[model samples]
Target: MTRSVALLAVLAVALLTALSSIFIVDERQKALVLQFGRVVDVKEDPGLAFKLPLIQEVVYYDDRILSRDLDPIEVTPLDDRRLVVDAFARYRIADVNQFRQATGAAGDQSIAVAGRRLDSILRSQTREILGSVSSNDILSSDRAALMLRIRNGAIRDAEALGLEVIDVRLKRTDLPRENLDATFARMRAEREREATDERARGQEAAQRIRAQADRTVVELTSDARRDAEIIRGEADANRNAIFAEAYGADAEFFQFYRSLAAYRASLLEGNSTMVISPDSEFFNYLKSDLGTQ
Candidate 1:
């Protein structure tokens, strides 16, 4: 009975020792082998790993790429204008050994170190890039180019820290609320002033065109009146000249005929006042007629 109990106790201890020696490393995990408080090996492959019971320890680390969304950071442009810039980045561990050397996996020291490095790199890069450009450029199509520069800069600076920057992108860019309102108001006023100036120019041009048209009308009207007056004067002169020519050709007959017309017109009047001799040339036709009657 004593031998059986000792055998059972030995088996239990062996089982516990075997359990302690066996450690599991999943495909998503990278583990470091620590022996006597010092890391002896790094295991990135997925499988079962062996460690001495109560002598070696294993530390697990995440090997996947991580995303960091930086909050909106305020920066001043070259023109001394303030802007809020929101950015994000994707990074992964390139050198697990160096990562572990710099920051242990316990207590999130690795992530904290990465976060600080990323923040410092991002802040310095963003300030440098934004300070060299105008606010309009930062907000406009140049943002693509600026993002490329930022990513390149991060990749260059963060590689020594066992970090590979996959991409850096700007999510949002904005001005302060007060500045936005002031800028919009100024732009509105400038556009309205330009419109007013254009309208004034258009009106002035229209007035000039109208004035020129009125002058042309006045000139045409005056020319027509002058031409009509000249034509009328010519017609009157022609009529007088024709009559004079006919009268000059037969002066004695014209005079005798005119005197006979005058006697007929004067003798038929309602008021009779004859103060002429009977032998006068005015009564020649009247007297002959009277004799014949």
Candidate 2:
């Protein structure tokens, strides 16, 4: 009976110790067991785990992707342009041993403190990189290259803290509100001046074209008039020539007929003629025998 009672006590104690050794590993967590204040083992797998009861302690940490948003920082571009940058970073603990050694069992304290230090470090690095680049370069789509360089630099600096930065992204970049208004004013003035100059040049070109067209119209009208005058003069000369030829073929008949036409045109209707002697030279043709016939 005494032997059985001692064996039962031992089994009860063992059961109690076994119950105390029970631990859990979640899908996103990794744990480290410390024996006598020294890291004895690390549990990286999920599900139920056991450790030396009342002698070992467990430290749990997240292994999933973690992100932190940094504060706003000022960066100066190569063109002397000032910009405000707001960014965030993604990271995951890659080396558990290094993480533990660097953090010194501070656990979550490292992340909270890192958040502050990283803000200052990133701000400084951002200003350095931005100061080396032009404003246009920073504003361009290729600024991703600059971002990659900064992220790599951050990763190198963060290696001492056992933090692995997966990527860094710039969320917003903008000029200060005080400078924005001034910039817009200057841009508006420049655009207005350009528009005015363009309009003036267009008007000048149109005037030149219109003047040239008017000169051409005048030249065409003058040329047509000269040609028409020449043609009319030619027709008049032909008619005169025909009359002269016809008259030259019979001079005496032409003279007599012309004088009679002139007398008929000068005499008035129903008037008695009271001229000089009828034997005048004007009446010589009338006195001739041909005139009598």
Candidate 3:
């Protein structure tokens, strides 16, 4: 019985030693082997790896890209316009030794610490760079260029933290609520002023058109009156010439015709009345048989 117990104890010790000597590294993970709190090995390959049991420890970090959304921060641009900016960053751990050294911790704790540091660096850079440009630049096509600059600046500073900043992007940018209200009001006032100016211009044009029309009407009326007066004068002169020619050709006949015309004018109206002596020239036509002939 004593010999059988000794063999079982040796088998049990071997199983425990075998289990403790081996560790696994997944495809998505990178591992660091630390001996007595000092990093001794880095395992980047997947599958099984061997280490001294109870003497070495393994720390695994994700090898995939990670994303972080920073909090919204307020900034003022060169134009003195205030804005609230929200941004996000994409990064990955590029150097395990540097990451370990910078974070001074392992796994999740290290990632948490790195995140805080990254936030600080990104926030500072965002403020500095954004503050140097005009608000119009932020709101224009140059926005892409500004974001690129921020990403480059972040990558430069993140290198010391063993983080490779792949990209940094602005998620949202907007004015403060009070500023937005003021801007809207200003825009409305400007539109109103433009509308007023347009109306005044329209009125001025209408007045000009009316004045032109009035002038044209006065000119046309004056021309029509002048033409009528000239035509009347010509007709009167023609009548006078015909009368003179008739008188020159036959004075007796002309006198007889003139007396008849005068008699007709004085007696044509039913209510017309005239008083004259029988010897008057106006009565000569009425009394003479020559008028009838």
Best by lDDT: 3
lDDT of 3 by residue, 150-253 (tens): 99999999999999999999998999999999999999999999999999999999999999999999999999999999999999999999989999999989
lDDT of each: 0.84, 0.81, 0.92
- Candidate 2, 74: how far from true, in Å? 1.8
Which has the better lDDT: candidate 2, or candidate 3? 3
CA displacement after TM-score superposition, residue 192 of candidate 2 (Å): 2.2
Q: Compose the digit string of candidate 2's lDDT tens values, residues 1-293.
A: 99999999999999999988999989898888888878888888899999999989888888898888888887888787888888888888777667778767546886676666666656767777778989888877778988888788888877877778888888888887777788899999999999999999999999999999999999999999999999999999997787677689876777677768866776768975756786666666667867422
After TM-score superposition, the amount by which residue 77's alpha carbon in candidate 3 deviates from its true location, in angstroms, is 2.4
RMSD of each: 7.6, 7.4, 4.5
The top-ranked prediction according to TM-score is: 3
Q: For model 3, what is the alpha-carbon lDDT of residue 207?
A: 100
lDDT of 2: 0.81
Give one digit per residue, the lDDT tens place, for model 1 in 111-140.
887778788898889888888889988989
